[model samples]
Target: MNDSPGWASPGSAPSDEPDRGTEEQPTPAADADGPAAEQPSPPNWSKEQPPAGQWSSPGIPGQSGPAGGATRARAGSIPHQGGWYGQPAGGPPMWGAGWSPAPQAAKPGVIPLRPLGVGEILDGAASTMRAHWRTVLGISLIVAAVSQTLVTVVSGLWFQGTGRKAAPDGSSTPALRQAMRDMADTLAGSAVTSLIGLLATLVATGLLTMVTSRAVLGRSVTVAQAWQDARGQLLRLLGLLILYPLMIFAIAAAGLAPGIILMATGTPEAGLLLMVFGGLAATVVSVWLAVRYSLASPALMLEKQGVIASMRRSAKLVRGSWWRVLGIQLLSFVLVALVESIIQIPATLIAFVLDGQSLMDWANGTADSAGWTFLIAMGIGAVISSALTFPISAGVTALLYMDQRIRREALDLELARAAGLPGYGTDTTSAAAPGAPTDTSGDPTPGS
Candidate 1:
């Protein structure tokens, strides 16, 4: 049996050891006629020589002496063999045995959470769009547009412009426009306000949830895909969307229970006290619940969970992470507000200026505001603002939702598995619905 070190370490393990050591070791069969067999006296001790028992490199044997036990084969110790690793003649494999591994870069489409600077969020959104443009662009645009649309309609209904309300066209205002616009600030507008709020909430929740699911998967999908994925579960999502704020309202309203006891049988002061406590409790409850269940939309979109399931999932994912989400949300709100103020204020100021009213007259609410042109322009400005602001806001919420799951469940790893990326965990396709806007569970190929 031949037990050469080159055959041992870089090559192949030495063939099973000879049964007994004392017998003269048999030379390898193919090499019997080779030069080593023909050598009469000279033996090169330094190279191509290995100790008998299971050799591993311990130290390079000094030129003067035998290595203590094991030998450290020097650079030239083994002859280079090409066909072993099937390299072309005269060159090594691109990645050779001597190469050390490199540190891997972050997976594409990931949003890192280190303190991001101005435009970081936009950059993240743009990167996501660039990477999964086919997957993300249409859906993002659709969602963005729809979200903006809903917000625009709702805002138009809820907040009155300074002048007569015109039809969407810049045409003349309707006969009852002033009355309707005036009623916007009255109790009668409550119904219109609630309905608009509900619709807006539903659209935003479904879209943002989809964004979250795709983000976690490190995948991008389009509006059609998102809409399709969400179409079936939308009612449920809407219910959930309405439920959250409603629950908060209910809790806050509960504070009125004590005051109601006094008022129901007796005095106005009891009712007043109930209103005060109820209002305060509602404020605190609403804020906390909004933050707590922020993740619920994605949970539903990805997990097909019920309202409770989604809420619980969100609550669990956000248990200790509320403040971070809150801060991110607040930041987004400020951006939205800043951008909106910048755009709308000028339009408003222009309207006030052109209305032929003095500054004092306008401030005193006695200004005869500009006609339908001003209102139409204001509507256009509002729509444009909503279009730009809402999409990014939706994107951030979705991104944040995905990030939470990634941190808690190693969802990114699971997503990698789904995307056929190396080093991922179990594939999660089954967790998503059939016909859902996900393409992660397929094999990946190069050079199609």
Candidate 2:
């Protein structure tokens, strides 16, 4: 084999001749200066070649000598045939035989440029928040404070007089009416507050997606920069967020509608049985679809895709990784829930203690208003929980999308170039490497 660098294949070798060892040796003529010719060689020529198989290939272990025990070639020397330093043509190089250790992947930012494990994904998210706390936490805090304040105000004013009102005579009819009234009021208040929060969450997700992308490149971004980068796609992102939940709701409602109709027509027992079966099937379907499209948000933000296009991109990426995606997403949800509970529980207890009278009135179904102190304290807790949890949730999602891309599309090369890593950014050949995505238009493609 050719022992020269850049000659990876036998066909590229400089010659096809057999080694000189196979040729017959000629008798040497007497030296013109016989005594001087027998003298010891000069210092430059005195060093003897090391024994065969003395060196191993870099990065590879255990292998000794070149392929087939052929003589080793010096560095920068070219062999007439065979492979590098006697490595067999078409075979890998031996350790220390014209080989160097592979470069460690470039890690300019939160994650190394490679396919990531679950722990690494989680760690990358946390690292992004830690490394760029001011920008990340600032975005979270603003969104959380605004959303939580709206929710608190709506709960306080809209449901102040919504407690159950039993009649003086203790009639079942009045008690039933009051229960229905309270249920309706609670649902209405919850719906309004949830909508407010959802809007806030949409904005936070878009901005944080941008922040996490930059973080992965080992770059920090300010809040304004994140906003600028993400602003163009915010509407499409909002459309995606709205469409995904509506799709889930539609599936659930379709599953339950048949049962509701049957019950209304007076077949209560059969309707109830059907409802249970239908609900389970619907839940399975919903979960499958949710995992399939969980990556749409990041695709929309980074790829500048339309809502439908982004969803299609996500589905393509997640086609064969449904369970893995679901597991990671579920883990993130559990973590966020735990964080929220830890922060809010103490605040809730404090609020309850400070407004015991209002709590008692509500318990007795005689509350006329939500106490200001209680509402304020609970809102503070909500804000704090949201502030901390938002970054984690958004960071996990963005990083997960990146991980999927790196695994399936060889995205790390592009990321490395974007990060300006040496060799990666300057290599013109990597663009044509096998399995590397070549499309630069940002259009949604099944394999890209």
Candidate 3:
């Protein structure tokens, strides 16, 4: 084990076993293949330990140790056979033979997850959305417009033909009725539009991440620049698009089949039971998928990893954080739906008016069922909802990935280092020797 803390002062090395609270700077070394690599400068943190047996949390200031380390065992800066400042026992060793004590985490409510409320989720999402309002709304609108236009125009033509039929008198139906049904078909075909919207969203989502991260660091990038940063991962992004939907469909379909079978059984009680079971199954599946892919975009976008690599990395990062990821996702979806509802209301009302149905008439289904009018009305509503909802949905997912990193890795510091922020790790003046392996970088990770 390279006994030195990853960024500790050179002389601050553990005494025989380094003493806590001392730090020094290490000098760089020659590059292995070419020139020597330089050392990293002045240590960032001074290790602090309480009485050795009294599990000291080595985490940075302000963060608490997990539940007083009450759940399982000891909490300390002890280097376990499993790495990280943890108290891992007889399982596989993390990073390698060391325990990095975990810090207390922040949740979404009760200041963080204790007293959860739906409004907290809605308001948080709203705040996040507002922060990136330009990108969020712009991308969603673009998605809505492009997808809606294609589906509407194409279906209008397709249904126009499908609506045509010979009467018993061997005559075609009236052009107006055919036209109206064609429009309705186009409106119903919004699913196709939704798929294309997903692709547009892949782009929007990735770029939002780059831009938002920059914003977090008090920097900004033009949308075009953000797009460039996101461009390299397009293939991986598309791969995720394919894989994710298939997984969602397969699980949901599998869950739904059981419910359908139960419902088909004679007893309503059986049907209700099956529904409850099926819903639970689907919920589990969604949570599993969300956690699995929580880090995929970051892995792909920032690490320049491929689709499978990204997926594998994301899965690893979320190994112990499943429910938390699921909750965040659930909260995100619910918030998006609420936002869509607000947008849907006004559009629906306007459409109803345009279609010759008064709000009350339509609400009560008392208006004349003018086929063409109905098609146009519904079509308008779909178009509007798609435009407004698409971007924010995509943006929220990207934001979730960022939040995950922040919570798990203290990634803001890593990002700062990457950006060459003052006092950050990567600057040459403050650089660490690349080749002088303390062999400790992966210590926090277990047996990796």
Q: Where is model 1 more than 4 Å wrong at Cα?
A: 1-105, 112-123, 129-185, 215-220, 256-278, 353-360, 368-370, 425-448
In the range 291-324, model 1's lDDT, one tens digit per residue, is 8988777677666678898889888877877787
- What TM value does model 2 have? 0.75
TM-score of each: 0.58, 0.75, 0.55
Each model's C-alpha lDDT? 0.57, 0.77, 0.55
Q: Judging by TM-score, tell me the better candidate of 1 and 2.
A: 2
Model 3: residues with Cα > 4 Å off, grouped in runs: 1-140, 159-191, 255-283, 358-391, 425-448
**Best-fitting candidate, scored by TM-score:** 2
lDDT order of candidates, top first? 2, 1, 3
* lDDT tens per residue, model 3, 1-448: 4211134432244558754544785656666788767545776765785533323334334343445543323443344221344434443233322344454323321112112234543344455446656765665566556665665565555454342332335448775675676567766665665666677667666766555444443343565666666777787888887888788888887877776777787667777788788878987977678677876876677556788888987886666667766777677777668867887777667766676666676556455444454455656677677655554455455455545554555544444443454445445222222331111122110001
Worst 10 residues of 3 by lDDT: 439-448
Candidate 3 lDDT: 0.55
**Which 10 residues in a row give candidate 2 its minimum summed lDDT?**
439-448
- Angstrom error of the Cα, residue 50, model 2: value is 13
